[model samples]
Target: MRKTATTLADGRELIYFDDTEPYTSGAATRELRDRRDLDPVAATSTMRYDVLTGEWVTLASHRNSRTFLPAVAECPLCPTRADRPATEIPAEDYDVVVFENRFPSLARGAEPPATDHVDGDDLWPQRPASGRCEVVCFTSDHDLGFAELPLPRVRTVLAALVDRTRALSALPGIAQVYCFENRGEEIGVTLGHPHGQIYAYPALPPRTEALLRQSRAHHARTGRVLLRDVLDAERRSGRRIVATTEHWTAYVPAAARWPVEVHVAPNRDVADLTELRDPELEDLAALYLDVLGRLDRFFDGVGKLPYIAGWHQAPVEEGRELGRLYLQVFSLMRAPHRMKFLAGSESGMGAWISDTTPEAIAARFRAIAPGPVPS
Candidate 1:
């Protein structure tokens, strides 16, 4: 397969992939917007790909369809009571299970794929839809989140992620593996369960592609791995660093795009958690749980503080080796009851304006008590 891409006049990224065996060319396009142009309350849902930048955009208007507060009995992810059947339970006893989504936005059945239209009323060129999404049930217990999970359980969950990445990447048409978890409804999680999502895509994701390209360029110029060098610098500076062990370190990013963004990277370079030794995985998991616990302490045990956590691994392909794996976790909520909404400047202009200082946030996190971990 031959891949080609270029930037558009409007600063959007476009990529195309050509296959010799299949005799087909696949292309994708996307753009960064200032604000979503949709009725968040009225539109049930809509998915679009911005041709200029080459990224998939999913607008879930139904997010605001229901009332803000729902009874615990009505929670879809909750376990069934004595009178209810076992079907009402999200899953049986399992540490982590990957299953097909019941209500996925990128369903295999979503019709009239964006690539079908060469030219429509207002739609510019779009790319074919070729991606699969699976939900990773983190734990059987509804109350156990990443922060609450025992260290050994967290390692099991990370192992599950590694297994899923290896399994999904080996599929016939997968090029990228995206694993992410959204905690709390403030981050738009409908279900209040301890679960995450895995998206095995047929093509390289735009943001991943951009970071990979940047890492390659940086490596070419410096003859050193980008993330490894950055992690070393953070350790040497000892300012933004929040928590660190022999193998891993967690710190506030110097160029954070969000107010409460924290990045956890290996003290040594590794492609993914799968590549780490068992001991290293345990250390990493310990740090992960510690940081999350501090986050909980930061907001005085506000469990509903919305946050997103994900593993950014190198592409599954062999050629994309310059990239290093890292975990990026950020909260949309600036505080317990406050949110940082992406309005006009952030949504339409592709610019981020943060109100708090990274230094201050790092200091605040550092002051929080690091709870003991079993590992």
Candidate 2:
């Protein structure tokens, strides 16, 4: 693989990862400069600590002003043209590109103004939103979905993520690195391009904290890895298992809260994406493609599904022993024409109630053969 990093017009970092031999072998000539004259935007975000919930809430009001879904010609993720205004990517074409988010929820090394609220007070203390948020464009095409990419392309995407994970973890204050994709409008995707995001947080998020607590307690109690045990239990039951290969297993979690949820875990206990072997990555690409193909046709009338796919890896500074690498892919679509809303029980009370059972969902996923959706 070939990797090149450059600074965008606004002083943010943009990188390109090429998988072709010509690029990797340094036999292809390329334009490595960004050709736009843009002024830097003064943006900083603050984080308030929720004393009641023990969580951090980022206040990035500027996100409301970011671009929404635009026409294909005005898509910000597409390559730039000489006759058109320069988009986020300055290059005319790219295989996979990653850059810092223009409207970021968290800014690296940014210092927000201090507040007069008492630090000892229950719910008044605040801090700077010091971290990073990066956007990873999976393909240059405006209409391509991740599942439609070829395996070699998928492998390259994985490689890009792996490199970012390692690089982001080494950043001075980053605590956790989250790589995820929000696809389709139902998933609250403002852009229609095939892309995912990476969030490098200064503090461990609540979800990862809870996971570490569980993992540590489980290890202390059973002396076995938590994720490995879960995988074994699923394999033994065979009720929620969707698909399994020599290196990985994809299954609907036994206590799934979403209408459609699948967890694809490696057969061996791996700390993060950077630890996966070459054979493991290849097998992962194949299995992930299969699972996504089934998801595209889950509903009878919906040709493509709206979903969120995220990787839960070990935190950068802590929980290295108990942290495990895995992916959780779930959709919000409840039926052919219905949607799953986080109503009172879910959003207001923090309790989730799914309409479909895990076994049934697993069976549905298994029954659907991998194929293209009807045009």
Most lDDT-accurate candidate: 2
Cα deviation in Å at residue 186, candidate 1?
1.3
Off by over 4 Å in 1: 1-49, 58-71, 74-82, 86-92, 107-115, 120-123, 300-304, 372-375
For all the candidates, what are their Cα RMSDs to the real structure?
12.9, 2.1
Candidates in order have lDDT scores of 0.66, 0.87
Model 2 has an lDDT value of: 0.87
Candidate 1 lDDT, tens digit per residue, 91-195? 223344455444444434334444444556356544444455667666557767778877666776777777778877777767777889988876667777777
Error of 1 at 16 (Å): 37
Query: What does candidate 2's lDDT look like per residue over 1-375, in tens digits?
Result: 788887787889888887765553122214535566776744578888877788888888878888898878888898777777778887777788899998899888677656634364656778888899999999888888999998999999999899999999999988888999999887678999899999999899999999899999999999988888999999999999999999999999999988999999999889899899999999999999999999988888788899999999988878878888899999998998588999999988899899999998999999999986544
